[model samples]
Target: MPIHYSIEIADAAAHLFAIELTIDTPDPKGQILELPVWIPGSYLIREFARNIVQIAAFSKQKTIPIEKLSKSSWRIAPTTGPLTIRYEVYAFDLSVRGAYLDQTRAFFNGTSVFLAAKGFETLPCSVQIKADSFSAMSKQWQVATGLCAAAVNDNGFGHYTAQNYDELIDCPVEISDFSKIEFEACGVPHQMVISGRHHADMERLAHDLRLICEYQIRLFGEPAPFNRYVFMTMAVGDGYGGLEHRNSTALICKRTDLPEIGSEQQSDGYRQFLGLCSHEYFHSWNVKRIKPAAYAPYDLQQENYSRLLWAFEGITSYYDDLSLLRCGLITFEQYLHLLAQTATAVERGYGRKRQSLEESSFDTWVKYYRQDENTPNEVVSYYTKGALVALCLDLHIRAETQNQKSLDDVMRALWNQFGRHFDTLGQGIKEHEWETIAQAVTGLDLTAFFDMALRSTTDLPLSNLLEKIGVQSQLRLASNPTDKGGWQDNPVPSACTWGVRTADDPQGVKLTHVLRHGAACAAGLAAGDVVIAINGLKASASQFASLASNAKSGQCYQVHAFRRDELMQFELVARDAIADTWGFCKSKDSCQVNKEMLATFLRN
Candidate 1:
């Protein structure tokens, strides 16, 4: 029998959702019900079942014996036949990974709200949504989701069907008086639904979004894959995140990031929001459809590791911004600045010296998601470095083939090889398959490049690789430093550049971090130390920041701070900034062919 489910806001004030699971046929031994311990997209295993409360099983108004087998699984003794399980979930977690509810709105992911029947997982399931009856505000709420329509109406409220339980949860439902606008890309209908009480410029959003969507579709040589797609965004006071699904994505952004009415100028916040949108949208192809070997069949009971996140997340990240540039959402200068910013961020981090991209991908469950104070000192980011790997590969292919083939060709080849055939094969790309395909597509043997990038913690040769893309580079300080011994003996007591980050508290300026080799560490100032004064002067948060950049070079200062309420002082010398300069310009000697290749890359 079909596995059927229904979800409703039982109590909006308490943020509780009532869920009912019905199975028309029960296993002769017993009926097993389990909620997922985690969701895809986010690597961390968040115990989603812990939120379920007050569960009961009934076969025909007769109580069936219930037994808890594990953290996420339950079993029911055999009864008359069709078994029904009713439960209430306390859905207050506001992030995109789980369920959330309030008088203002309601949102829930399938893993957070649906209970899967063990034997019927592969069978079709249906979700029936009920209107909120918990509060006056919920009365006016509407619904938006990506689930295929079985009995749902135009307002997106009612029954939705999925091919299986996996597909059921892949589409999250949002209910509120959100602003939803429909647009078409490559003859496919797409919806952008924003949930919040805000004045967003939907016209501009749909216009720019169409361009990005069309560019991506054209890039992979597919008119469209899904019947319909959705962008379910929650605009909040301050937040940023997204989780991708098969046909939709759930996103959260600061309310100010949305386009305001009558504003033609795109703010940095709006650009960042657009980038977020593009990032998640690109996942529809990269991570969602093009399955990684480790993630081809996710084991939601525990952590799943893979060394191809760089290929999945990194490549998508590389293309997200590039797609924007290709679509003319931003200028060529803006794209260069974005590239430089990414390079600067990756190079300055000391962790890149300790970990390789493959290691970073494998250890994400332990290191990337769960970070410590020493994270910057030990861990490298697969996303940033991986994007560089993609960038390097792009230039290598272009330079090798003399601009005849680019990374765009590599992606299309991958799509044809893995993505388009993912459903039937269910086998993701293997680790070695990357080089094999790159060689087959670009005719370039990249053994040395891939070895240096994935196997060792060596810095990417950006200066060398960028030359292929017609961009010249130089190593210089991101910021200049004052010459030593250039200050007077009593140099008006100015501040100088120091490498300490601080925040404000009632007592004084609290040290947030002391860079590994910075003056603060040299002076023994710990992370929690509050600086009450520096050199017998008041050290307020603002005052300390002013002095940090303006202070004299090589000057020793009598710094006084509270180390856990104990007064202490140290003689700290001024140091320069610990940041890297990432500026790229067109190579002076770049031939016309190389220049045209660069133009084709950025302007395509």
Candidate 2:
């Protein structure tokens, strides 16, 4: 018999969800049920069980003893008949990874509420949502999710079914007075369910998303894996994140980042939103189905380590914005602008020289998720550097094979071998298997390239590879902190820099990061120091930049800062900013072969 669940918004105003789980054939001995401590896609142990405000078990309407075995597990004494586990979850986390509820809306991931009956996780399951629990707003509220509807009402209140616990939790549920826009890609129905407030141009969004979806679909070839897909989003004043699922993804973004109605020009924020959408959608094939061996059977209780996240996340990152250019949503110049910014971001970080991509992937739990002020100096992002690695690999394959086979071929081969039959075969790519697959697909041995990119901290040969495709590249000094790399004609550098980032503080200018070997580091200034004065002149966040800019080349400035209630004084000498920003442009010395290759690389 199928395990069943029914969840109701117990108190919308208090952000409570009351759920009941029924097991028809629970183990005769003590049965243990567990709530996953973490959710997949996002590499963080969130300890979802802490949100359980209250819980109890019963058999035949009589309260039964339930022993708390661990933080997230419970053992119910032997029950004669069917067992029922009831719990109330406090769901106020507003991000896509957790649960949230208010009078305005309610959202939840299965990991936050559903309990998996040990040894029976592979059994079929069903869930019923009590959408009418909120009498005042029940009429307008509707449900949106990827779960197969078993007996849902017109407003999407009722029952949903899943083949197993994994399938059930992989799909998140969103209920609110949301605006939905429907579109189709490759004959598969797709919908975007948006919560919160926004004046988004639905038609334009549908048009652009359709193009992106079609391109990605065609990339992996005909029969798409999912029958339908959903983009469930919550818009706020300022937010940005997304977590992928099999047939849908939950997203949060600033309302202003959405395309405005009747606006013809694309804003940078809107482009970023579109890029985020592309990134998660691409995961439907890459990370969602294309499994890393460590993730194939995810141990939701603890950390799952892999040395190949660079391949999954990095390759997806490389393709996210590139899809915008290939789909005609952005121009070639705009694409180059985005690429240069990514390269510059990696170049500016001192940690890239200290941490290898493999180490970064392995330590994602401790380093990537729990970042502090010294993050830039101690850690390298697998997303950015990994994308650069993917870029190098792509160019290398193209160059060696004379454009006969590309990274596209390698992805297709992975899909056919590992991802396509994943549901049935339950297999994943081994740690070193990607190299083997790439070699087989392109008929090129890339062991040296992989070793250098993953195991060593050596910078990628990006400029050289980009030049072969007729794109001239150069590194330049940034004029300001907000200056991300792009083509600039005779860009002027800042007069001087402290090599530190700062934010406005009520008391003074708060230092955020002190780059290694910078003036701040030399002067013994650390992150979290609040600078009160510079050369005896009162320093504020606004005035700090101008004061640093006006410093003489050889003059030292007296700096007064507060380091945790202790006033410290130091002498600082400003120096020229580093040339770490990258700029790119079409090469004037392009030959016919180079032009052909460039055309193929950026093919629409």
Candidate 3:
């Protein structure tokens, strides 16, 4: 007999909604029920089960009391025959990861559903959802799941079955006014269901997505791994982000984020939106399938630590925008400009001060996702610097092998060894396993690269890497005044600076490390010194830039500062700003090397 489960969503009132689940099964001794501690793609340990308010269970019309087994699992007493279980999940928050209920709508992630069975953890189960009639106002309520035998009902409910927990967690369902657009990319059926107020040029978006898929396939020299793909978008107000999955992705974005075609400024926004799309799309290979061992069989209850996020997220980030360029969606200049912006942002943050890339990856839960004012001063972004690291490593590989091998080789080797070969039973790729793969692919030791580049804060030779790819990394000083009227400066010499990087704390303008003898440092200021005033005016992070803009070379003024809780004053002198620092250079040789390495790398 088929194991059966059902869900019903009822509109109780505005600011409140009700969800009910019913399940039927015969065996109880071997049954195990659990709620996922975290969702994939988003690497944080959030106990979603804590949100459950009231629960009840019944067997053969007799009431059964449920017992808590663990933080995320529960147990039901032994039953003689077929058992029926029911419960209600609370929905009160409106965030992307949480369940939210309101007068207008209700959103939930599947882990909220309670299960009861004998060895339920191992038993194959089926779910049938019963939607309220009012749900018809949504136009259509669709389910995005990996479960088998799924069907939709006229009452707005859908039915699906999961072979196991892995399949169950992979699927996410949405009930709303969703527009479903289907097309084929690289011979794979691709579907996009956009909900919540999507007003962009759907046709153009669809065409662009098709091209993106084709480009990715060409990169790997094969069709995508999934037979079908889904892009499910949840639109709220002003939010923008997404999480990737094996066969589908969930996107949370603002309706206004979609840009109109044929408009100049809107084109930039469109490119950004597409960049997000490409980022998640590339995950189909780089992350979703070819995952690090730590993430292979994810532990939802706590952090899954890995140092290779730079490889997973950073490399994917580099390609997200590059995919746009390769598909002729963006210009080379635009690509470089985007890189420059990313580089400058990476150079300005204080996060780099407290965390290295590997540490940043390992501590993403505490540092990256949870950001504060000191973030700029204390934490480095794995996404930004991680991409740069990928570029550096790719160039290093190319330069060492005379353009015969590159980072792409590492990616394909991963796909072949871990992704294609591994089954659900073998879910992760170990750290040393990646090292072994890299050594085999490149015929060289990657220990130094992993140690120095991935683990250590050794300055990346970005210019050399860019030059190898026929791109110049240009770093120019700002001679022009910023809107705030400060001589835009970086804290490091030959570094790009915007004059002020501030923390939200009232530690009162501590001069965090002035870039190796920058304007602030050259004027005899050291890091850890708090600026009390700029040119005799009380200053904040925002105000310092304005003061710097109005000043000229050889301008001297009394600068008050506090260091180690002691107030001190110094005479500061400003110097004329330098215009450009040639950061990277590339010739025909480097370009050819880059192309050849890329080709070989993708070919495995």
Which tens-of-lDDT digit does each residue in 1-604 have in candidate 1? 2788988877878899999999988887898888988899988878999999889999978988899999999999976678999999999988999999988888999999999899788899888886434324655577888888777655667788898887888999888888889999998999999998678999899999999999988888776668889999999999999999988999999999999999999887898889888988898888887767778777777888888888888888888888888999997667666777677767766788888899998999889888776677678888888888888888877777888888888888888888887766777877678778878888888889889988898888888877766776644453332221111222222334556666788878887766577788888877888888888988888777767667667878888888886899888888865435576666669877767887878865
Q: How does candidate 1 fare on TM-score? A: 0.93
Per-candidate TM vs. native? 0.93, 0.98, 0.81
Better-scoring candidate (TM-score), 1 or 3:
1
lDDT of 2 by residue, 1-604 (tens): 4599999988888899999999987888988999999999889889999999899999999998999999999999998888999999999999999999999999999999999999889889999987568435568999999999989888899899999999999999999999999999999999999999999998998999999999999999978899999999999999999999999999999999999998999999999999999999999999888989999888898999998889999999999998999999998889889999999999989999999999999999999888988989989999999888988898888889898888989999999999999999889899999889999999988999988999999999998998878999988877666789998988765567888989999888999999998888998999999999987888888788876667665568989999999999999888877789999999998988789788999982
lDDT (10s digit) by residue, model 3, range 1-604: 2466666554435332344433455445634556777777777777877766666667778987678889877777767666565556667655556565544445555654544343444566666655554354454555444345456665336667777656565666665656677889988988887777666667777888998888887676575777788787776677788777667777777777675546445365578878888999899888777888887666665678887787789999988887887787886667666766677667655456557888988888887887654466677888988888777777788778887787777777777777665555456677667667887899888798878766776766787666655665556654333211111234223322333344533744766556433466566676677887766787576666545566676777788888777888877776555543223323435555566654443333
Q: Which stretches of candidate 1 lie over 4 Å from their true place?
A: 132-139, 478-497, 586-590
| Residue 324 in model 3: lDDT | 86
What is candidate 3's CA lDDT for residue 26?
42
Question: How do these models rank on TM-score, best leading?
Answer: 2, 1, 3
Per-residue lDDT of 597 in model 3 = 54
**Rank order by lDDT, top first?**
2, 1, 3
Best by lDDT: 2
